[model samples]
Target: MATTPAGRHIRNPQGTGGRLRADILAAAGRILESTGSDDAVTLRAIAREAGITAPAIYAHFADRDAIRRTVIEQTFTQLATVLTTAADTEHEPVARLHVVCHAYLDFAARRPHHYRLLFERHRAARGADAGPAAPDVGSIVGADAFGVLLQAADSCIRSGASTAVDPVASATRVWVGLHGQATLQASLPWFPWPPADRLATDVVRRMADLR
Candidate 1:
């Protein structure tokens, strides 16, 4: 087996390091989505999906948790992009807020497994210490999806479109409400849900006190 300049075993001497890493992450994502549980996202399963041996995963990820962390970060980064795009198109603060809310719901609906992995399963795994100050948010690192919502709420409050005095508090309330709606919709698709647009708009308006 050929080794890199640093003397580490090159799992696939024919494959570039970056490509192999991406393949491993993608494989792990598939397993997480299919199983809808973190427990199933094992190194062996990812290796099988990636057509590599289990030890090869270690070349890119230190352990299962590292892969899990990367997957969550990537998911949140994508979500942040979606939310940012949704807010950018609308000039009006209230309209932007509504668009962002709908975008979040849409993302959750489209990526139910990813959504569950990030919000549901991950939270449960944190046990009783997963409070507001939990490290999960900090662990996400670069992406700040919640910050996008906060900025919109802050703009609305400043523009008099919303009566909320505290942007952070208002945004947190809106986020909590949106999370509940999204999780419920994803978890209970068979249950009757009001039109998504209407429900999302109503929640945003009521929570943000949007005019």
Candidate 2:
């Protein structure tokens, strides 16, 4: 631990600040998942969960929103990694796209809270006038996650496997379909839904024009 000029002790010391920040984020994530609400991820709660004083958090994060934003960014990276790993399991463009779509749905089904947090927060941010905001494609987190679909669609087009001319447009449409399916399935688990793989295959074939 280190002491400031005023003799207040800082729990993280000098070189371990990054670790403390990560701990704070992990604590916040746990609170979010447990309570299923961002309101519960207050600084005091996170500090308590991390076994530190509330003042200690101020040294690492400006406030609760900073920590929450970092958590969301990390979550997006995790999603991108999942999609990339799924896509790597196949070589053919159409098959790769199908797997990636299924992977997207699987991620939602497995982590419903985190998935809901992503879009729910965006909708709250967008206000009613603009409608729900899709992930910001310009941000690094958004680009990394959505870029996987763009690459898969482009591959299909280049390989003569897809009839779509514009990869970006096709990818955007496919993403909308996947998002709709995932959200609906999660919110209405009792609904008679088609097989996930079949739904994903149909989406890829229709949205990307996969042959």
Model 1, CA-based lDDT: 0.81
lDDT of 1 by residue, 117-189 (tens): 7864454334345475555443434338988888899999999999889998898889988999998887788
| Model 1 spans > 4 angstroms off | 1-15, 121-143
Best by TM-score: 1
Q: Which pairs of residues collide in candidate 1?
A: none
TM-scores of the models, in the given order?
Answer: 0.84, 0.83
How many clashing residue pairs, candidate 2?
A: 0
